[model samples]
Target: MIAQLTALERTYAAIILVVIMCVGVAMAVVGRGDLFAVHGWIIAAYAMAVMVVLLRDIDAPEPWEEHFREYYDDPTKVGIILSLIWGVIAMAIGVWVASLLAWPDLTFDAAWASFGRLRPVHTSGVIFGFGGNALIATSFHVLQRTTRARLPDQLSPWFVLLGYNLFCVLAATGYLMGMTQSKEYAEPEWYADLWLVVVWVVYFAIYIRTLARRREPHIYVANWYYMAFILVVAILHIVNNLAVPVSIGHAKSYSLFSGVQDAMTQWWYGHNAVAFFLTSGFLGMMYYYLPKRAGRPIYSYRMSIISFWGITFMYMWAGSHHLHYTALPHWVQTLGMVFSLVLLVPSWASAGNALLTLNGAWHKVRDDAVLRFMMLAAIFYGITTFEGSFMAIRAVNSLSHYTDWTVGHVHVGALGWVAMITFGSLYALVPWMWKRPALYSARLVEVHFWLALAGTVVYVFAMWNSGIIQGLMWRTYDPNGTLTYSFLDTLVAMHPYYIARAFGGLLFLTGIVIAFYNIWMTITLPAPVDEGAASDLPVEPPAPRAWAQAGE
Candidate 1:
């Protein structure tokens, strides 16, 4: 990828790295006796390392100017590899966390080894590190194809990709150092949050600039979802992360909100992070990849547009449902619940639209593991949205709140819907990105599909059973009105389920390892002997004399 870069671009890149190194040094000097100082060193060291790599390739022959007119995919390739690496690491951390629940003495006695410290690492790694990278990579690829336009500039795409990753690394390390804003998904402190804001603005600019350069007159449905994902997430991050840092050098900050308002704000960010970042971004992927892989057009474009606006309008109000039966106002809670129930229409509309798009492709889904991955993801998306809406009700929340049921519900969405769709998309994307005829092994794709399915089922069922049992035990009462089950009893009952959960997570992590090996081998496969000057896409059949080509 680096060998193709023009000399001027490489020189500009090196100059930027030098500036970053100076900033890192200043940060290191200013932030002594705090984790901020350590991150400063990380920044400086990372800048220097990338600089050396750029220097090594600085003198390579420039790429063809004609090739520059094609889609700029170097950043997408790097993003894919990085996403897989983060997925493995984060899933492994998740397995360790599950084990810790089963046996608390699993880790060495250290501050960073505690479950509290490591839990956020696992969450941030999977959500931002793994899932976020996948979104960014796919969005770049989808944007270009749907619009028939190359990215506006090579340098800015690199800035968005690597700069965003820098934020992720800072977030992961800061968690280990016990520095946090103490919010749920918005845990990274003010510095990291500010860095993300900078990265995101550039990301948005890339989207906007590329659209302005599009050859196609009408933007595709996939780009609409991607744009919504980008815009909404920017708003959510800035508003929820508002805070005053203790100092420029210190790693502490206080939220601008206090009390119930704070709780409302945090969950508002949390749930929409799921909505836009997790759901909408992946939905964009699903719209493009599923139809392409199945060799079918979307069944109803009209329904897709309707679903898009419905989801955008309703999900913002639904986040308040998470604070049900709390100190939040009754009307606000009721409003949230109402919107959440209404949200099921659009959610299921999307899910159903995807399924109906598979009208003639059911046979392909049965035979093609790649298609099956997406098929199951759609089913899970439907089921999970229904579960989320059901749980939003006040009556259900009474039993489910503060119970493992909530945890179970989250995994149903995460493991079943999010991870499944991501893997499906990558499976379809990897061969095209590498210009390969096929993956290293088709059987291995089958192996991965089954293992992932099994793991998700096992993990979710254990949580459901354990959660219900925990909730029941806590609520059990005697005739005298005293609780029959102590809190310790609930803890004791969870032991077996925790062990089951760990085993399930290990199974999922094992599938990730297998995928890593498969993808590595695919990337390393030698080019075809007759493949000179050929695009990765398959040749399309010649159309009838009267039929038009591209769809709206």
Candidate 2:
């Protein structure tokens, strides 16, 4: 069975096993305390499990035939599984943090359970762990299909997938250990950042190589958005994470920039991390999956091209809006604001294009749960972008900044746009990847969709109301020009909204849990057999779809 594996697969397995063993030994020898020791044990146990799996596969019989051997999807399968796992973890943490806000004593005085430490865990887990893996997986799947070419190599895909997840693990664990460079959305310490750089470079190389070998003359618009996401994220990550590590073994690091410069640099990274990482990559998913599921061509391929370039160009300049009224130069702030407002054009263009593509498919959008998710995501994208532009204006920023309004806006995109699109894509892909006819439960899909929509709406409204109330209270002045409301009074007022936010998050999480179960059963349950079948033979797979055939 081991002999059945391609040489590359065997080599990868051996290398991973060796690396895991070496890391475990090193940690056992020089780990600082119980935390490090426990981590080492976990690594060792995981390595052992991996070894067993490899050995079992080695002993299995080789396949008699290898049809559909042109494409690589194992990495995608791994990514989807990891994405679901991380989604649960990220949302659970988010709910817990919301609870912390509502009931401050929920932390129980434990440092590790504090909101500050866990907040990054939620953000990084969802963005990088959940969303990032989905992007990586779908990008590979979509890029290959759109280009009509296979990935450059099998090993590189595995390296990027596994190595990227490793970076996520390091980032999440480091946060728990109080190790960070203090950069929003770039919280991973110096070493973790370096690891991600290496992984990202390999990903880029694989993508470019595959594109170069494409059978199609025109690169699909989806690939363009995906490429932009990869290129810009690499540039932003490296630039923002230029820090000096205390030592090779230690997690401590100091940023290369300081003071006002540091603040500007951090927000520059923060905002664009939203733009490229969260927005662009998922837009790539939207472009591919939406049309494929809707059975229609893109509304305007030309508009997609325009929106892609416009968004990429405009987003880089808009980050400074985050520093409105800060020590950053006034002109720079204004520049950020102007660019942010201009960003609405391309944002709405993309959203409109997506919606217009569904012009004759409204019935499908209404009937199909997956299409509903994508359509809602596109709609939310427009709403969030419009709101973001409005809030960037100086006058609006004066009220929204330092308030939960910004939080609400972020989730309008994060939960409504990002997660919704991701869920839709996964619903469309999981059965295909597993060679199933359909989802295990369509009813569950419908249920999950309504839960997600309800949860997101409730969550956003609660935050918006709390934020406006807080802003009003802060700005209210008495007849004598003294503050009318104290800070504690605002906190007391926010308690109800915070509780609502937590309840909303719980609803969202419940939906995710249902999704996970449905996917799990879809993959594991035996396919239903035909009633009148005479012989006991495996069913032949269906022929490829038109788009898939064209790509090939």
Candidate 3:
């Protein structure tokens, strides 16, 4: 095992271990009995685990071929594993928070368990922890394969993966410790935000370095989307999170912008976080994985190029729509609305391109659970983007703003689109990474598909109903022009829908648990032998299609 690691891996592992130990010690010195103390102890234990894995060489034995060393990096496997682990943790927290919304008494008198704190934890856990890892992992895998070039350096890949996750850890724990900049999606305080900037810059460098070394004549469409996501996110994050720290040791900070400017900045960051982080990054995943899994080439590379440019141009201006009916200037709000409405064209262009790519692969869509997941994801992308466009309109925004409808719209993208696509990609990725012929259980994949689909339907519909009802009740008027329904009356009406949403979350959580079990078994269990093969011999699966091949 030790013989297999290049000097680069050993050096990176040692650096990571030292950093972990140092951070743990620093936390102990400063954080004493706070949540940071608990975080420090966990870091120490994690360092020990890393020591054992790095020293013991738990990776499978390397292939004998020399060329195998030049094409792929193994850190992608680690990224995938972390993505799934974080997905489960995030969804579990999401379910707990949903239950809290339904029954506020569930807080159990614990301030840490309150919805405000845990909400950020769930959002960051899923967005940065789960979704971020997926982007990193898939981007690395896709960039190499599409470019037909090896990563420039092994150590940098590991550094990006571990460093990005460490930032996620800090953000999550900071939320629990009541640390925030009070920005919607950019809540992590000054220090954590600065740490992320360092990590993200390294990430961008890694992408550019790999691209510069590509053997392919033309860069693939997918990498363009990924690069846009990486670059635009860095800009948005730095601009939105600019603040003055109270002290080097303290976790508090004040925003550079105040009042209306601050609100505009936050929503701009918030909406675009959805755009670039969730939508653009995942679109990159779709461009590669969807067609690859369906055994088809992209429907129209030209259309994809158009969609890519359109989305990037339109999404940035659309953030001001989130400030509709607020103190933000009316002209700015109208401009945002127009841009958001225009965004629908490019959004559908991408979604349609994916669906059309599967034109001849309907049979695969039926038989392959992975394809089913990706197909549903594309459909949801279309639905959610259309819904978003409508909601951005001034008339529709009047009813949708501050309502569960917005929440429902988000999950249509998050749970139905982002998570489904991620699960499908991972299902495809796990077997390849572990050198297994297939997943441990195909039946479990089918079961999980249904569970996820059903859960999303129930959850979205419940929220839609709740939102519309709340909107109607709020605007209702008596003969004397008094309110027709009290706010408490609307709350009472929403109780059933809240409970239904929680049930939907429970169903989704069950699917995630099943997926985790399947992935675990795939890694740990031995491959099955063919019917007529020797007992000691395991069957190797057929090679993937050209587009699906790793490192080309």
Candidate 4:
């Protein structure tokens, strides 16, 4: 049966009218609500409806038809490519910011080019632009694979990718142009925020409809993590970006919250943005790609569910940890610290589960670069989570707050863990999508791994030692009890470590360049044989399983 939404469509229309009436009555009752506020809601709802209608129109084909129907290559492919390109650029900007912190004079005293403006640029590019695009691309890929259905709609995937990139371009350019709301991660001007609202809603619809048509016995474990990320981020973005624009072009705006309340709101948005954006979203990639690359099933099906909900429950409370030793209430800070410590249990559960899943397939790690990437990503995940919980502790916070240690911890996750897994997944996916026999150069992939690994090791250790030394120097007191060392003294000591960190970043970038060449060659080679066509060719005898050969 060709599906029809006739009755549901009528209900949707009627609900919009009732929502309008309710808003009118509430505005009259409250006496402070404005026409503009209600108008924004009405327009937002209508745009959502249009998207739903469009989603239903495309009628994505069955999976078996993918090869023959000349599948449009899933418009999400463009989003994945954008994610990879932006991942490099974002990390490059991060390296620039890291360099600035190490050598403050790198800015050369230009206002627009200064560290303060570029800091937000670095953070947003990596988090929202790079991390966000990775989540979108992988979710589309995972959803289609699990559901055994083609992507739900045509125009939607393209709309999402283009609209999102437009948002990124606008936000990046606006920051350089001195346009912002001065919020940390939410600094984009009101116009750009509004544009994101549109892109995100389309993303939500695309995910939901794909789930609705799924043919699997149950939704896979990975979808749970991806769905949580999608859901929470929508709520977070809307609440944090509620502001009154002075005008579209000039970029001035007023937040809905004021004073300490505003600070509270900002960190609340900030930390959870890290939670949902970096932690939850990457967990999605881990669940799917980790097992697939290992050529094995996940160790425990039930454990995945338990940890998913546990992390979700625990992480939302840990956001207040950022406000510790600040004007925020003591109880709130304590609550955050407690939750931060508790988060370790669930986080370790996911990490351990990933490693244990490879129990019988350990040698795959030596042979498969993709497997090696995933396994090491799990190892880094463990290190980052432990460091994160320690930093949230008040005792450690006293020494490490505002130091380079924070930067090191973040890169352990971003570069060592998240970027590693994403790269491995892309390596696996590109060949599959292009239907290539194998990567053009496995040796190149191995070389890329060593370079990235060496870079991350040097980068993290340099920051760690320098940060601890700086903290100790500042806290030291002479016999006179005068301030022991001026802040500048600590800065002078950090030059060598800073130089090392920059060189490490260059090594990591070089690895990515090698990967680009290897992948490009693989895709451009001769066409692969179709599964049906391969039946006409002779088959070779299979090698004995590794475990069986070892036994006797």
Candidate 5:
């Protein structure tokens, strides 16, 4: 039993306890201002907690790690396929919603399929289903490569994939069944939410265990973002979704908070859901795959660490900016705005770092479609951060709030930054995961990139113009002290912008379908392999020392 306490296990067990103690002491110290005393107590409490957990862990036998018994990379293949499938579905629904906005009558008078119902369906499907699957599939691949070990048991990996997709199925079906909590992002009812909680916990445990067993001396930067995404999302989901189901069959339930408090909590959850889930998670993919593809080292190791911690700390407070000019305390609003503005530092620090990493690789920027996508994403990351900071200012919020300008800001991040990076990573990952030579058509990739870019720019500018026009018109007053333009007039004025947006969406959808077809052809095309296969696949070599510059 004494022999069970390996140095590594003891180290991890101690760190876990220190983390717990730090959390508790943070709460207490914030509650009271006796910092010196609290600091001393916190250190003691952390040491004690570490000892206790370590003592318990000492007797527990280490788990037996699993090896891949099957010859085929079924999980990787299936996951990639599912991610592509869901991505198309999600984008299709998104285009449908865009059309619905352009012309509300497209709902066809079906209550189950109306804009109110379908909007959430599209958002959840894309954000959770498409983006979520992509992250999981790629993380699994990256984890394996970085760790130099096979994933946990095949069954559990399957569980993480199928179980998650099953949750998505339940969620989409429940919405069609008119079952919902009506929360913006957390729309799934309690049962579905509960199901997701279980899947996510397994996801987290698998990730941690994988990292723990890694052969590398230091963890990769991508793993940091991935793990942060898993951990913080767990905390956010549980905190924001404190609800009791009326019944399993019932579609309705109440949140734990009420009134303005509820609004605060909802946006708090909503905005950070964007920050952690959408932003930080993809940033991890960018950090790992971009430099790997470019055959370049990261610009600065210190900058990456700064960005990581800065984003982790600053993002939580900036959620209140979503509720600006509301009844949330003035101090809270102030905190949100300040952090949002200051967030530009770390955000651009990351963006600049990525861009600078390409200093010697500018020629590749012209020749490599993957680098082009990633570099453009970094540029847009800088743009969106600037826009977000500007929008957080009360003066700007008064004009842009409840307008198409905000929609433009979001799409800049979504389409330009997040989707672009995902595409880049997928372009690189798909071939590597499948052991294919390269993409079927570089020309198709170029066409896809240009179409996506044109569509995004057109869509963003149209909405920006429409939103600002509407905002100004709403606040415009006649010199004789009467409203200058009715709301109907503003809506009518937006028709042209809406039409342009729909056209852009159509182009974007077509480009995605083209990409899907291209990838499909790549997979289905004939290939050659040696007749005599080795009994054991070769292990991946450790990442080069320069690769260390990316994340640590």
Candidate 6:
């Protein structure tokens, strides 16, 4: 990967790392005796190590002329690997988290391992660490293909990839150290959030720059969704993380908004983080790879347009539904509920468009586990989006709020939609990326598909059961008008379902393990040349651009 850069580029990379190292050292010195100092040391050591690698490779040869002709994919490759590793780690932690609730003594007296601290580690790890990496990696692949142009530069992709990972590392480690601003989904401290803002700006710049370099007459739908993901997420992260740090040395901060404003700001960020980051980005992946793999054009281009605009316009307003029946004014909640229900139109449109694209590809769906993964993901997308709309209603929110139903709804999206589509895209991408005819073992792919499906079903079902029982128990009353069940009673009732949820999560994690191994073997093992494999490689690399020929 380092050899992909020119000598000058390598030197530039080293210089960038030098600046990061200096920042880390300054942080370490100023934040002595604090956990923030630990992160400083981590950052410094990481930067120094990467800087050394760049320096050692600084004099190495630049890529051949053929390199600039092709898409820059090193970052995507590394991003995929990092994403898989994080997915396995985070999903395992998720299972452990579920077990903690069931047993309530599984922490083993470790403060860092407590449910409060580790839950965010699990959430942020999978969401940002795993899912974020996948989105960035796949976006690079989709963008270059859709635009018929290479990335604007090599170094910026790595900068965005590594810098974003640094933010993930900071957020995860800080959570373990109990350093949080207490906002859901935006838990990282002020410095980490600021670092992300810087990284995201560069990411957005890279997208715009690449689009400017496109040879195509028009941007593809995939780029539109990916751009929305990039643009909207940057806006959401910046606004929600606006905080005043107590001191530069301290890993603590107060939000710019407080009271109900803080609550509103947070859910706004939270919901749209789901909208753009999880839904929109993966929809981009779907728009590209799903049709490509199925050998069909999208069913309705106009519907795709409707889906994009509707989601973009509506999702921002739906966040207030999360505050239903709270101190937040009823009108705001009603507005949120209305938007949430209306969001179903575009949500279903996107889902329907994906499914209809497979009209004549049912044979492939039957024979190919990879396509099955994507198809099920679309189905789940439809189901979960509908569930979200249903739960957003004030009456439904009353039962679902603070219950395991909400958790179920999220996992439907997380496990069923996000993870499924990601794995499907990766499975489709890995062989093509590694230049293999097919996977190392098709049987393993089948095994993984079934495991993932079974896991999602069991997990969601268990949560649904757990949530409804809890909701009903909490609201049930005796003749004396007192609640019939204590919170503990609900816990005891949901204990079995928690165990089931954990087991289901374990199944899902096992599938990811299988996927990682399958992908690793496909990359490492030699391909057997055969007729079936010869025609599978893509033929989309455009003629080298004029500036690229000039070695710019």
Using lDDT as the measure, which candidate wins? 6
Clashing pairs in 4: none
Best by TM-score: 6
lDDT of 5: 0.77
> Model-by-model lDDT, in order?
0.89, 0.87, 0.86, 0.76, 0.77, 0.92
- Candidate 6 colliding pairs: none
lDDT of 1: 0.89
Q: Which stretch of 10 consecutive residues in model 5 shows the poorest summed lDDT?
A: 63-72
Residue-level lDDT tens digits of model 6 in 286-387: 999999999999999989988999999999999999999899999999999999999999999999999999999999999999999999999999999999
From the highest TM-score down, the ranking of the candidates is 6, 1, 2, 3, 5, 4
All candidates: CA RMSD (Å): 6.6, 5.6, 5.7, 10.9, 13.3, 3.9
The Cα error of candidate 3 at residue 34, in Å, is 7.4
lDDT of 5 at 499: 88
Q: What is the per-residue lDDT of model 2 for residues 1-552, given as tens digits with 9 covering 90 to 100?
A: 344345557667768777876776676555555345444555566566667767765534333244234567778988999999999999999999999999899988888888889999999999998999999999989988998887876667877887788788877887887767778889887756877898899999998999899999999989888988999999999999999866544556799999889988888888999999999999999999999999999999999999999999999999999998889999999999999999999999999999999999999999999899999999999999999999999999999999999999999999999999999999999977777778999999999999999999999999999999999999999999999999999999999999999999999999999999999999999876665442343344343223334456
Q: Which pairs clash in model 3?
A: none
Where does candidate 1 stray beyond 4 Å? 528-552
Better of 4 and 6 by TM-score: 6
Per-residue error (Å), model 2, residue 203: 1.0
Q: Residue 511 of candidate 5: its Cα lDDT?
A: 74
**Per-residue alpha-carbon lDDT of model 5 for 473-518, expressed as tens digits?**
9899999989999989998999999989888877777777877888
| CA shift of 414, model 2, Å | 0.6
Task: List where candidate 4 sits over 4 angstroms from the true fold.
Answer: 1-72, 102-111, 528-552
Clashes of each: 0, 2, 0, 0, 1, 0
- What's each prediction's TM-score? 0.95, 0.92, 0.91, 0.82, 0.83, 0.96
Give me the runs in candidate 3 sitting further than 4 Å from their true place: 1-4, 16-20, 23-70, 531-552
> Against the true structure, candidate 3 has what lDDT?
0.86
